[model samples]
Target: MLTLSRRFAAVAFSALALVACGAAGDGAGTSGANPSEANADGELGHVLGQADAPLTIIEYASPTCPACKYFHDTVKPTIEEKYISTGKVKFVFREYPLNEIDVAAYAMARCAGDDKFFDVLDDLFENQEGIRYAAQNGVVKTTLGAIGQRHGIADTATFEACLSNSEIRQALADTYATSEKWGVEGTPTFIIDGVKHNFQGEYTTAEGFSKQIDAKLAELGAQ
Candidate 1:
């Protein structure tokens, strides 16, 4: 049920996702922004959990990725409650925007700042139905802007400003560099304690994810 413009956008996203496979992984050009890249201060990406948590889960996700929306809607609550809230797992979220609209979403998320990143993400995932509808009608940006205002971004001018914010742009580029290092080619790719886990049929449920995480924790003697 995509409108013409939305169909075009979807095609572009798929193309960019394919291109990211090649564009993101050129070694020296990546500039040391892989997952392991961090400062003495702390982890660089949006994060939640105790710093010394037994296990770390790094996720590269797209705002417009349906599978990602599914994960957020269903599986994430369990993982967060059981692992993250319990101080057993640390979660890091990075953007892997696949198109211009996806980039706009990421920019607004960044503009919301580190403190509100997860909140903004929560709202986005919770409202994906509306987002998808808006996308089909060629008003995705307007829809996202409405979402942004609810998060204090306020007004069309500032919302547009978020799209071109240089700092946010750089952070996103760094994620592509990180994806290059890790060979991530899809959404909801989870790196659990350095192991890359894909989000698909087997990983659409919390039980499946917990099985892998529990095993990893035991193996690391952190269980």
Candidate 2:
């Protein structure tokens, strides 16, 4: 079992590479309404809204994070309705797994592939409480296996294989490296147009987030 302290230590070291290499943009343009695109490797994370939306909001989150679940359940819908659907904001979800189980869940979610990624992600967040219970009771494998089946995975073997995939694990680690470079200290961190925004405990609601985003859009002269 991977402990959080050790994981964070790894992040601290990997972030040194980021400093040496310089801060790379999220494969999106810094000026104008440059559309977000999958990297050359075809990894775009899980994205929503148009690629060319004026504002791109990159979120670093873990499926098991309670704050992340609240954002998904309470805040995301409002943002989708007001910004994503309107082409004003493009959203990108990146994995910042906080524990072994979080890594497993993310791997399985990606194993489902891009078409079903967000759907599986939703299910995971929505059922987080049950998953936590299962983990505490030592049935995490069974719990996650059932969740995988519900999302079209064949069986426990397949789920285990997905969880053991080196490639997927590497990709997830790379995402964490990027997040570390960006100074993400916790889950539910947001980066708007390359500017890091720590959750200030003030805007956990849609209205609050909107106020900040709208202000940024106006500053950038984006409609």
Candidate 3:
């Protein structure tokens, strides 16, 4: 049984290489791996977004990340409404679990399945502080199970099973590996095409984040 501290340590170590790359300014770029292969699985492939969209923005986040929750719940909806829905751009979400706490959260999110991913995402964000305390106190199962029950998951057994799943942990590790390759340092980091944009100050409001996105998009040639 990996304790919360142990899990978070492993997760942090796994991302060290990425954090270094970010410090070195190695930066991230579009995969350029061909949109066809990317869209083959309906956007769960290498890149996450509409295959044909002119602008693609991928948000790398951890469910337990406060900043990430703020960005997703506050900043993201506006971006999605104004850009993603209109098809001017595509928004892709990638997991960049920052700690053991985040690992559990990520597991829960994945367990929710793709169709329910966003729903679970919102739920977790809503209770992020309580969940963090629960994780620290080794009450992850209780905290997360309660969340599952609220979403009508019913079977606490299945949900707990996901927490202990080796395959799921390995998959999470792989996601961190990919983040390392992309030079990700922290959560709420946005990558447009190949360029990385670090948010300035507290961008907790939709208007603030939207302004940055609009500026970046225009710089990328929205004209």
Candidate 4:
């Protein structure tokens, strides 16, 4: 049995090459390859809304982070409805797993294929508490496998294969490196048009965050 830690240990703080910001995964099974794909910033990760939307918000988040969950469950939907749906913003979510368990959970999401990427992420965020419980009870993979099954991962056998997949592991490591290069210090960090935007203090609420984005759109002379 490959203990979860040893399974994903190759990518933890060991300095891996960046994946050149496109194709959610290089090759292998997870996310596969799509060379011509890219976002408004010409960087690649899972994206929502128009590809050329003027505002591109890159979010660095962890699976287990409660704040990350809040943003996903609450803040994101509001932003999506107001900005992303209107072609004013391009949203990119990059995995910034803070622990070995988070890495495993994220790897399973990637394994579900790019087409199902966001679905898996949504499910993981929705069931984050259950996942934490499973991890505590020594049934993390089984829990993750169940989640994967709902997102086209097939069965436990296939689930296990992708969970321990070398390519997915490497891609995540590359994401980790890329996050460092971009100076991401915490989960839920947002970068708009190549600049980090902190939504703390008075900017914490949905209405508050929207005001900041609204100001940015105004500055850019809204399309």
Candidate 5:
């Protein structure tokens, strides 16, 4: 059976402690593409693929995580083509911001609304290298503004407003809280059929992921 590692357990505890103490800042304002359908609580996570697929995969990933960028740029397309588009699997992407900047990124993506959330997210991941450089150079806002413009955001003001939206901040915080409850300590954590799977220095490739996913599908008689 899959289990949470001791290190991850400690990390989860620390994250919960931070939430309990309210250390996670509330940043402010909001905007995006037309609002997409949301969960019962109005969280704007984007789900791709068939809703009733026998296999369900939810990924908790940080925008700034290099591993996540790699997964999105490489493995994700394959998964989409093979399983998601084929109606064999349902995939959900959840934001688990690791820092203030990551929270800002999530806010921007969420504000893009459900219709454009995944597109914005894809742009963010594709340009992660440039974004990291901009962040390091203290020009993250300017860089993000340009990115938003490319993705149909109205203007810099709108982009900034979205980044500062309090509601979006709360939604991101709630996502983190849920991740903690699930013992998710790191980015790109995959929850397959309610079982948590950490990267563990392997399974970073499409083939690797498929091996596990296929086994699960076979076990569930969904293949």
Candidate 6:
């Protein structure tokens, strides 16, 4: 059971997940700062694995996207195990939230900082259904506060404060501007070496992702 604070963080993170998809990816680069830095200030959009690795894979996703979670929980981990974990590749997660609710989720996650960003991310994806139910029934905000508490953000006041900040909203907008630059029209799109590949659903599987990765690696000739 996530405390309110954790839920808040999860929701914020989830919003960022969607925003990640919308963040800049055009050849002209992104706004504010490059997402590669540690203190990206939620401006990193979404990212994964190592940063300096040879191969860089950027994924644009939404929190409410079931397929996004499937890729995160199943497909992504497999890629991490075989490629990212070994330093053969690095991955970036970007937000591309489709609506206002999704935007709210990203705000909550930003409250927790980048350190807890991905951890809370996994939890949100794993419990997406439960969160949606709570939101639909009007208990979503409370549940999110509980989530914050579990994450050591026991200060409800602080959590709420973060959620309502104007800065977060600006960051969200920047994320969208960035996404549009990247030309994202859907979730789970992959950008490998700046070339975008939109998966037609099947890439959510481990084997399917692996095969595509292999193709990319082969194209690069492993060096």
**TM, every model:** 0.82, 0.80, 0.73, 0.80, 0.79, 0.75
Model 6 RMSD, rounded to 1 decimal:
7.7
For residues 1-223, write the lDDT of model 3, one tens digit per residue. Answer: 4445534332332332123212224444223333233322234313334556667776677766656666766677887788777766777777776666667777777776667777877888888767767765667667877887766566877776777789878877776665544556767666666555543343446787667667767876872
**Which residue pairs collide, candidate 4?**
none
lDDT of 4 by residue, 15-53 (tens): 211111121332221121121222323454788999878
Q: Which ten residues in a row have the lowest lDDT in candidate 5?
A: 28-37
Error of 4 at 174 (Å): 1.8
- State the lDDT of candidate 6 residue by residue for 1-223, as single tens digits: 1223234334433433322333323332222223343233333565556666767777777776765776787678788889988877877776677555556566677777778777667766777777777766667766666666666566878777767789877776776666554556767677666656664434657897788778777877863
Q: After superposition, how far is residue 63 of candidate 2 from its true place, in Å?
A: 0.9
Q: CA lDDT of 104 in candidate 2?
A: 86
The whole-model C-alpha lDDT of candidate 3 against the native structure comes to 0.62
lDDT of model 3 at position 219:
75
**In terms of TM-score, which candidate is strongest?**
1
| Model 5: residues with Cα > 4 Å off, grouped in runs | 1-44
Report the lDDT tens digits of candidate 1 across residue range 42-143.
Answer: 455788899889788888887766677778877889999999999999888888876666778878988987788888888887776687688777888788
Every model's Cα RMSD, please? 6.2, 7.8, 5.8, 9.4, 11.4, 7.7
What tens-digit string does per-residue lDDT give for candidate 2 at 134-214? 766667778778888989888977887898888888889887877754666766677777766654443477788888889
For all candidates in order, the CA lDDT equals 0.72, 0.72, 0.62, 0.70, 0.68, 0.63
RMSD of 1: 6.2
Residue 184 lDDT (model 3): 66
Off by over 4 Å in 4: 5-42
- Identify the superior model by lDDT, candidate 2 or candidate 5: 2
